[model samples]
Target: MYNKELIRNISIIAHIDHGKTTLVDRILEITSAIEQRKMHEQYLDTMDIERERGITIKATPVKVMYTADDGKTYEINIIDTPGHVDFSYEVSRSLAACEGAILLVDASQGVEAQTFANTYLALENDLEIIPVINKIDLPNANIQETISELEDLIGFTEEDCIKASGKTGEGVKEILKAIVDKIPAPSGDSGAPLKALIFDAEYDKYRGVIVHARIFEGTVRPGDKIMMFSSGETFEVTEVGIFTPELIPADSLSAGEVGYIIAGIKEVSSARIGDTITSADNPISEPLPGFREVKPMVYAGMFPGLPEYYGELRKALEKLKLNDPALVFEPENSPALGFGFRVGFLGLLHMDVVRERLEREFEIAVILTAPNVVYRVKMKNGEIVEITNPAKFPNDGEFEEVEEPYVELSIITPSEYMGNIIGFVTSEKRGEFKEVENAGKNRVVLKFIAPLSEIMFDFFDKLKAISRGFASMDYEIIGYRPSDLVKVTILVNKEVVDALSFIVHKDKEYAVAKKVVEKLKDLIPQHQFQIPIQAKSRGRIIARTDIKALRKDVLAKCYGGDITRKMKLLEKQREGKKRLREIGRVTIPQTAFLALLKIGEEDK
Candidate 1:
């Protein structure tokens, strides 16, 4: 049996591209977890999308055995988490499974918005934080400045911070030593009943659900009966294993151990993250304190490009949900786009990533509608309804008031771009400036309260353009506030396209409607008859554009004809065209729906 005192559970948290994965690579090398011939960069990032994007989307756990200077071997469990605000929930789940965390900061960039957000998450979880200055080998690395920011912002002393280069493996040994010496060993009673927290799970076609868990008390072995606390479903554990960065079969997993369990759970929803697992025969009276339910901030419709692929899309989403519990979807029907799911996401990037994964991984061509935020509407009869789809929203006279979601926005950028960022956020994005703080090293942190709908489309892209890619932002939904929000419906040839409808603020309704109608006019293919693209708001047509009909020259056949003959031919052609316009049905191409999602760029 392994000793509990020799095991350490820790996680590495940082901002995007702050070198968390690189640091994990160095640690794996120093500890000799994988053979030199088999090792590669970002070894823990097993997904193709992760490698291509150069970002970690999922939190990955790995186990490495290291020999300390005192000649004693120790088992270390490290969870490498994603840095984007959209995936901060992944970081929180990783933290819940660990006793300590390595707070990583970019040496040149100093403290960033996500760095602060992640640090606070760790603090909330009561994890021991060891500050690390990463990418120290760069010529522009300002280690001292970063260390100072860590001290002033996070209250970590100079000695508590470790300077390291993930590329050269410099100070890597110190990181390992700190994990063993500073971070406390896991505390649990092995003699008690089994109690493990399901931090994550994956689906294998042959093996079923492979649950990643951290054991807090007692022991679990093959053939033991386990039960999920939330679902009350019991299963016979078939095998237990540890991630030597890969699944390696183990005899048994005891208290203070981090590993996986294959319990023949065929249904993906049975093994939920944050659900407690314990002995089926001798169950715990109360479940462990689970994580807070994650509420999606942005919502959009995802439909298959081919109507026949709806079933395949559903299966793919089920499997993806097994891995990402943050994604929520439900079946919804649209008159224009057939049938699809209304999916909810944490942010715009999260929505994009899910769509890309659906296409690239599952090979399902998807059509995504314009993203929107959920709105609370109070009717004249005093009934409040939450609307996620614009087609379901009440008409102007039916609702007394409408409230939209807002977020607490934090931005960290250089002082030079502060004015431009402030002007854009306040004027264009409808953001209310809160305060500014000096973050040392000529950088400033700006705070704002912005409507989630305004930032859902192109806020981040515009921020990056104005700041020249130096600005980083993070936001959290701060309750709803009353707003003059109206639903803008799009029509092609006087037929409503439910999928193209979106909700917008009343003040900017005309501008947004004009943009959408104009974009649709260019995207929708011309038919035999004229197609009028119109945007409707508050029972009135606010903006309209026309796609000219395809015409055949009647004059070409009238060559050498007299003027009266030409006029008669022209009159006949006009009558036929008018009849065709009344009966012709315009088919809106799929590209038009996709293009309408990006109408915000025109405003920029």
Candidate 2:
């Protein structure tokens, strides 16, 4: 019953919306793991948020028993990994669990920003890359051009590539066959001390920390003492499970197969993604290698719609933390916004996903501040400090040394937008434009190395606008360099609010400061009394804004309703009003308050 030499461990990877999930669905259908009568599309990305957003946020593992033409049942463990650049760490984490990857390219879109981003991750892991051109049968499909680009960009030979329409199940069997041929067999000894690389793990009410890892060496059975390297945790393996496309009870999983280990560890840190799981006694010499810490690239302040909902917000975050280990939050007090949380994320996409999940999954309405890149600045005393919130900065004269993280970015767009992109980048005082290459007669590629802080927000929106939605962009973190930057703090009623501040390059500080004050003035409603809006730097107010008095309003008019009905409506308005932090006796609506906190100006 065991055929170790024939098993294939592979992961399917691609850009967002590039059909990696669809391809997985087709593979499951062909292998008959999924009952045909109720077969669906994008089966692997089962989260409701994923389906609604059409992006994969978490990686899932499935197993299919395929009967090859030689009449042999080969167990193929296929892992469906997240496809977005924000989750590149997830990609790297899951890649360690597989021997090969199917890099799916959109037939018409060719090599997109995310496709290149994830492909580079696969290459770095030294996994065999199987090129697959998907959606071959679409009306706008440009298979020939995409094939040529794949050869040029990723160095994949035409003969080594597979073509398939995941929608109609065309060429589905061929892709499956390629996995069996291209990926390597499991080679570690089952007798050696058990070691596995944890790709994804979660906690269950009944099962404790359920870890999904690929057995690299040795075998583990029930009642085995397991230690997780990441958390320095030790717990006895209570149960072993296998994939029936879903977790099922198993006696043990041998080397090269993906399985789950349930231990009595309760904390989430015990089974962290990308951590190593090994035996406690008969201890492994070394933990499974290739572990890297995840860092949060974006920072923001999260507040409740009302002060009474602060407890509700905490519960939502705690629940979300159960699923998203990458999210980090700490209690932060803002003079203007009152008590809130300063949250961190891997990047913008990661931040957006967390926000969307909070709103959609928890049904908690929140006030989110503008995201800023974390900065490492050296003070006048020559000591380096990591700064996230702009309010943490000292007076400009006190800082003699400063450095900001930079990134090398690649952007591809239609030829017509090339000039606009170049001008926009140069004008914004961000990255230095290196060069532009002609991909074809109508397509152009541009490269730039920029300060991460400069392009934190509006870059995506601006790029899409210039390219008419045809540009795809990607970025990688480069080392930091010294920068001449300053902090511009916004003051409402001559009072500085830590949440209403930002860091900017020296040359552009005044302009950005003006915009910030003006936008805040527009968003912050007229107060009961006149209020002053000003931007200050080094104790000097750089810009000023005044909010006029709140002149008029009609009280609730419930003529015919019962006392309970009137009271309920009044309660709603009262609750909404109470949630608004009264800064010097002025009420702020939730929507305008969030807008004033962001970086970019509103649309005209």
Candidate 1, residues 188-238, lDDT tens digits: the string is 998899999988888888999999999999999999999999989999999
**lDDT (10s digit) by residue, model 2, range 173-283:** 998888877788877888888788989877676766678889988888899988877666789888888776678888888888888888787766667888888888877
Candidate 1 Cα outliers beyond 4 Å, as residue runs: 332-339, 379-384, 525-529, 548-575, 600-604
| Model 2 bad stretches (over 4 Å) | 435-444, 524-530, 547-592, 599-604
TM-score of each: 0.92, 0.89
Candidate 1 at 538: error in angstroms? 1.0
340: Cα error in model 2, Å: 2.0
The window of 10 residues in a row where model 1 has the poorest summed lDDT is 595-604
